[model samples]
Target: MLKKAGIAIGLLSVLTGYLIHHPIPAKVPDPWLFQILTDVLAFSELMGTISERVGINRWWAYPGRLPVPRWMNVPEGMKIEKTVFHGIESVVVTPKGFAERKIPGPAIVVYHGGGWVFGNIDSYLPLLVTAAEHTGFLVMSPEYRLAPEHIFPIPFEDCLDTTLEFMSRAKEFNVDPKRIAIAGDSAGGNLAMAVTVELVKRKIAGTLVQVPAMQALIYPKLQMTNYLLPSYAQNREFIFSKDLIPKFWLSYIGLSSQYSLAQIICENAHIDFSNKQMAEKFALVHEDRVPTRYKQRPYNATPQSIPSDVKKLLDGKTKAYLNKMMLDERIAPLFASNKTLLHLPYTHVLVCEYDPLRDDGIILFERLQSLGKESSLQHLPNSLHAAASIGPFDKNLYHAKQNKILFEKVRDYLNNMH
Candidate 1:
């Protein structure tokens, strides 16, 4: 009995040591707790890799499939329900006494982020519930389909369809059609922007009835063409490392089998910057649009050589297919023209200094300003990626504080729209 107890204690100590020493590059205000969470995330990823080798290919989707407990506590002053909005599985949260309002209330449709692969509405309960209580706006979060199963257009379609159907039936939900806003973070933020741009196009074509009041994107990964932006290098090892993002992007677009392509992309050799037309297509994401303060770390634009096998692989159909997909405006809204952007509604962009996608948000805000569009930017110098979505699940006091600040800022912006 004594020997067995010693073995168990020894194993526990080893695990505790590994988690404590896990390398998290970002100097977040809450270091110990963040390290624990990062290890959890990395372990999930490692399991996905191991499962793939063993032919249990869908293990990555396990997180999305896990049951969200029905008894999970709702935020104070909020009421929550699981409902279907136009055939999409969703979660709805409304503030108490919302039904008694004399006027039709505002509503916001939020898409949850899990890098296009795993997050579901259940995982985002705290974020949605808090937003409902703080903003008094009816909040609807859709359980969009996951990738490596549904792929790009399907997830995008679900978000767009849910938004359109919600608008057309706003009276049923007691919402003002013109007062609804669309918002999301990370991959969901990418979907929100794409959906917003599509709505603008439909309006121009005399097809859209109710345009969204505004779009709020939180640290969205906007473009796949340029991964060498200053933030990619400056905060590469921050919560979401430079090496991991490409894998997410590849998996989303049904290109996971082409994993070797990640190397070509990180080096910025996938698209030829020398070609003026291609350069012009991605002009919005250029490093020049990023501000001087953001470029604190020196960035080298020099191209790195691709391995012989990868170079050979890219010389055929994969090359053409990738270029076409990367430049598709529907997939990468940052590839949209000035004319399309001018039609967009007021925009709020939130970026964190230690996020790898920081430049994506800043450049987007800069482009919107150049088009004379109404836009606002909120930059959190001490925060890391995924801070806002940490919401009520935050274990540390500092993350909880940041989550409150983020939601309150978003709430104030949406309220002003009214």
Candidate 2:
């Protein structure tokens, strides 16, 4: 009996391990290596869900909870420091020899991307370190509160407040107040632009704070009004299912437990597209603005009707609130007015061709260009989402190459800053 039990347990363990390492392959171009990486990530998401259901800490299976790699250690030429501003903890990475400089230099206040709820400052250290090393500038990442608890405006407010405080005390960090920029990846990219818009609006209204000199957004989630983007359908299962995008957005807005609504929102049912205000804003995300090459996938603009059963799931108050939140410029900066767009700081948009958020970044750049705003864009045709965050730690050759190219572009942009 003991021998039989041991054999059964061993077989079960092997099966579990295989399942964890063999998640359904995403639609990304790199099916071999990136698939393996995402498979592990998918298992982590499952663990996180199970832990949540069991009333255990959800972070136990969180991807950001993975052990840091030796490669992610502070690069030899960089030094890190922690400071508190507006009751939020922030990590600052400075290039070697920053202390002895006679004059203050440019700096970047970055927001880490984890779809809003998953990542922390430490999870993004590798990217921050690379930015500091490549750009030779002070880099800081705010540890903003995450969601399912903190929610939309709370996390957004935390970033905005921390950035304002950092700018006010820039001298202490050896950073030039006038040259400070705001940057972020994914959700962080959304915050960076939101913060920039808020600061510019404040400055326009005679506020005393200094506006960010630039905004660098990496494949940012810029709008919630339209999920029918070409990239969305094309790369729905690229890194993770595009269906998960609504889950993250819902989590950001504090509706995380409404899991059933994720698919509804993915079909663009949460939004009443015929509403005048919503239609106008969503038109900005129109496929026409997307370049001809990116339109390789089939996308139908006809709105998907909300089935009666699903309609019953959306209460009046909940639908109203979701509509309000989705259209807010602060939550979806892509809807900001041309007047506001004109005042935007210099901008750099980095997009990955195989990512769902690809069109968001591209449309943003195109809008800024149409308004004659000083802006630049870099599209990584062979890359996927989260490359900036995951590339530094992955051992894969393609990841390393993509990461190098990502940062090299960043470095050149910062170096050329006036």
Candidate 3:
């Protein structure tokens, strides 16, 4: 009995030693793990605050989470005009008075990103005004309804309808409808791609009257699948967390209840084999495209078996909008057919190196190249997602310079285009 007890103690000691040398997963649900995660997140938030306080960073934090510095305000030279168009209220901003620039020029239909839940035209007025001034184009910023209150197709429809109306009255606004560009950041970028897709599909069916001459997608949310991509893993704790992403999607789709969100997160809801197959095909990213440095981390994830209920949801229209083939190509504009791509006019994409969405832009650029599409890419090495929305005060000299370069590139692209 004493020998057996000694053997048991020896085994316990070995197990304890192994645990000491090789810690359990940080994501474990123990109370100690939760405390560590909370402390780490709090420290990250505090560091972000210090970075912004010293003018070394310009990340836009969630409201009440971070204090907005005074320097982030709009500059004095920008002229903001508040007006309602087609029952959608919006704000139009120009760098110079209308009289200062007497002649008509190119125009941009701008959309703001808020994960489809927050954000409005006013949030990005500074960037829009700057783009208009630098490109010498009339900028029209539209306001769209947030989700939960108005789910799925509502935001997409509002943007499409606004664009149609804007194009119809292009002449009245002293703009060239033929040279108009559609541009948006983040969720807005998703809408921009969706709008273009709808336009192309309609054009094929002879329903839509007009389509933008160009599209600028800044850090767009390209697909709902492949949530386990390298970027998602590498930047899981990024300003935008992987968990928070699904939360936003739930809120946008009117499933804000914690139980519903938890069901989706736990993969307990409807999901089927066919849906998994479709997602795999749609999210098939080339191994070579992903940077080598990012792949060095240890990741041992297994393919999840889709639940029958989830599969049913996938088959339904509620989640049908997220199918890989149909909605995938539509969402990931880069995956569109060459025939569709070739028809697209001049395109400019802005990517940020530190952002999880950076590779999405890169892959899209490569896809455009392969299809022989006219495209220009501006890569911002230091910027993060949604950097442009925070305005000039949040920007440093380097960011401003990069922004200028991007604006100039867009201007040159628009100027050279017919």
Ordered list by lDDT, greatest first: 2, 1, 3
Decide which is better by TM-score, 1 or 3.
1
Report the lDDT tens digits of candidate 3 across residue range 1-418: 9999999999987774443332223433232433333443444444444554565422234321244232234445666687766778877765555435566667778888877866666556667767776676778888888765677768877888888888888778777777788888888887887788778767877775787888888888765544555555555554423455665566565555431332354232323336765545444444345566545665433335655665444435645443422344544555566667777766788876556666666666777777788888887654556555433433444555666776677677767775
RMSD of each: 3.0, 2.9, 11.7
Among residues 3 or more apart in sequence or in different chains, the pairs in candidate 3 whose N, CA or C atoms overlap within 3 Å are: 269-310, 270-309, 270-310, 270-311, 271-310, 271-311
Candidate 3, RMSD to the unseen true structure: 11.7
> What is the per-residue lDDT of model 2 for residues 117-146, given as tens digits with 9 covering 90 to 100?
777887778788877876788998888998
- Global Cα lDDT for candidate 3: 0.62
* Ranking of all candidate structures by their TM-score, best first: 1, 2, 3
Give the alpha-carbon lDDT of every model.
0.78, 0.80, 0.62
Model 2, position 57: C-alpha lDDT score: 45
Task: List runs of model 3 lying over 4 Å from the truth.
Answer: 1-78, 97-103, 258-271, 275-335, 394-396
Best by lDDT: 2
The TM-score of candidate 1 is 0.90
